[model samples]
Target: MDLSMDPAYSITKSECVELCAGIRGEPYSVSVLKEGYCTAQSDGTFRADGTISLITGPRAVLVDTGGPWDRELLLSKLKEKDLTPAGVSVVVGTHGHSDHIGNLNLFPGATLIVGCDVSEGDRYLPNQLAEGQPYLIDDHVSVIPTPGHTGRDVSVLVKGTSAGTVLVAGDLFECCADEDSWRDLSENPELQEVGRQKALMDADVIIPGHGRLFRVHRTPLN
Candidate 1:
């Protein structure tokens, strides 16, 4: 679904961590698996949105495996959560960057879904998604393209409850970590701005690429 053509995904200039859309029910839980540190920036600022998300379900999906060095931590976090890599059937990336896609060697058996296409004969299995469209992996998951952090960058939106939405954002928002950090990280400022707006409008709970999990709540008007 092209969000641009779809009016339903309205753009809201939301204030992060201010609005509180509390978790209603845990039909599923999104565990933030802290991973590797992102490489330093051009301005000598060290940043890392290497955090990965583990969405627990009948068939689990591991979103963004951290850098190569983060393998131990990622695996330990999964073990703590009882999610063995063997059980991770789907491996989806928000974008193809070193820190984000570096840990792919861990899950050889899982289905690979990412920005670029890949194939190694029958040894490798891949699912390449269409650009500018939503990839409905299942009834509950949608991979929406938000080209800002990187042009091919995308974010994963997972349904938390019948009325609630969870956004697994990869490098989209670095949290309230710094105002300029997000702006600095954006490859295309205009497009990144647009994507951020849609995410704020549609997502109930946002799992930022580098920061902690946060919720978006609106104080109802009478």
Candidate 2:
């Protein structure tokens, strides 16, 4: 079904703030190990950093490892939670961007899902994300293809959280207040717009790829 066509709800963006404070819920507590940032240089260059998040639930899931520069910081954050690299059962990279999956080497035992591909070690597990199916990690966690930022981008959706449903949306949204800027960064603005609309309709809160956690305000379509 085309979720974008659902006419029951209207999605709107509001409230962008750094998640220096994490959100906790039953079975899953989300912690932002690092908040992503994008900066334009004086020259014609740009610097970008990816956000790193840890999802503690029935299974330990680490989302977006950040770039190589974040290796030590990643390790330190895990240690603060009394978790070791091996303790993470799954590692998800919303897309294959270097800034997002750079530290994947740290978790050799993890089940890796970068974009729509799922794998364990050298063996790849098949899934239907490309065909628009959501992969369920469990009843409360799912990896859904959000595409457009990249041809195969995906986002992790966690339900039953303290803040209601949280979509760890990668660049599916560059930031909460991205209405004016996302098109410039998107690979397929049209498709991404559909996905974004669906996301806003479904999530109560969103963890954007490069900023903070924001609330999704929904207005019922009569």
Candidate 3:
């Protein structure tokens, strides 16, 4: 099947973990933080904000903190799981949207990893440093520039776990299972496709900006 031509290429939900596991490799155990959709009232309406937390070695890295709507709820959930805000050593946003970055202020001490396109002029909270290119938070975890949903869009990848590689795709796919949600990716189909290709190649576990976690078959497109 020409998966690219298929709209399912945009968003299709299956037991990705199981599917990827069958591909002769370990699949990462993923936890979907928030799962739902949001609407944008203006020209820049980016929806599907959520969070993904990955335990890479001794450090815990967070990918994209959801919106103010779920900030308190998310915080409660983190606390319940015994994951304190202060304990997070790395906090990364897929992009600099208000929704994705709403709760960023909660993690004051974590290194703020962002894309090269994101400028210091950007409205980040105090004590946050904007970085460029792919950054390694640890020996096993890194944040890569995906840049499609927005100029600042990024994806987080965690390696060296039994669960394989997990890609926390903030707004990159927005639940690659919903057809209507494809419009939320970006108007530029080419960029969105590039982001899709990146996700497919880099991640075994595909964690969307919103919705439950799934696994992806990493095909070497190059």
Q: Per-residue alpha-carbon lDDT of model 3 for 42-91, expressed as tens digits?
A: 78854555654544336666666777776787788677657888887767
**Candidate 3: residue 122 lDDT (0-100):** 46
Q: What is the Cα-based TM-score of model 3?
A: 0.71
Candidate 1 backbone overlaps, count: 2
TM-score for each of the candidates? 0.77, 0.93, 0.71
The C-alpha lDDT values of all candidates are: 0.69, 0.87, 0.61
Report how far off residue 66 is in candidate 1 (Å).
Answer: 1.1
Model 1, 43-151: lDDT tens digits are 9887664768877766677889988878888889889878788888878788898778888878888877665443332454444444577777677776778788888
Order by lDDT, highest first: 2, 1, 3
List CA RMSD, all candidates: 5.1, 2.7, 6.5
Error of 1 at 112 (Å): 1.2
Question: In candidate 2, what residue range of length 10 has the lowest lDDT sum?
Answer: 1-10
lDDT computed for candidate 1: 0.69
- Show the lowest summed lDDT stretch of 10 residues, model 1: 16-25
Write the number of the candidate with greater lDDT, choosing between 1 and 2: 2
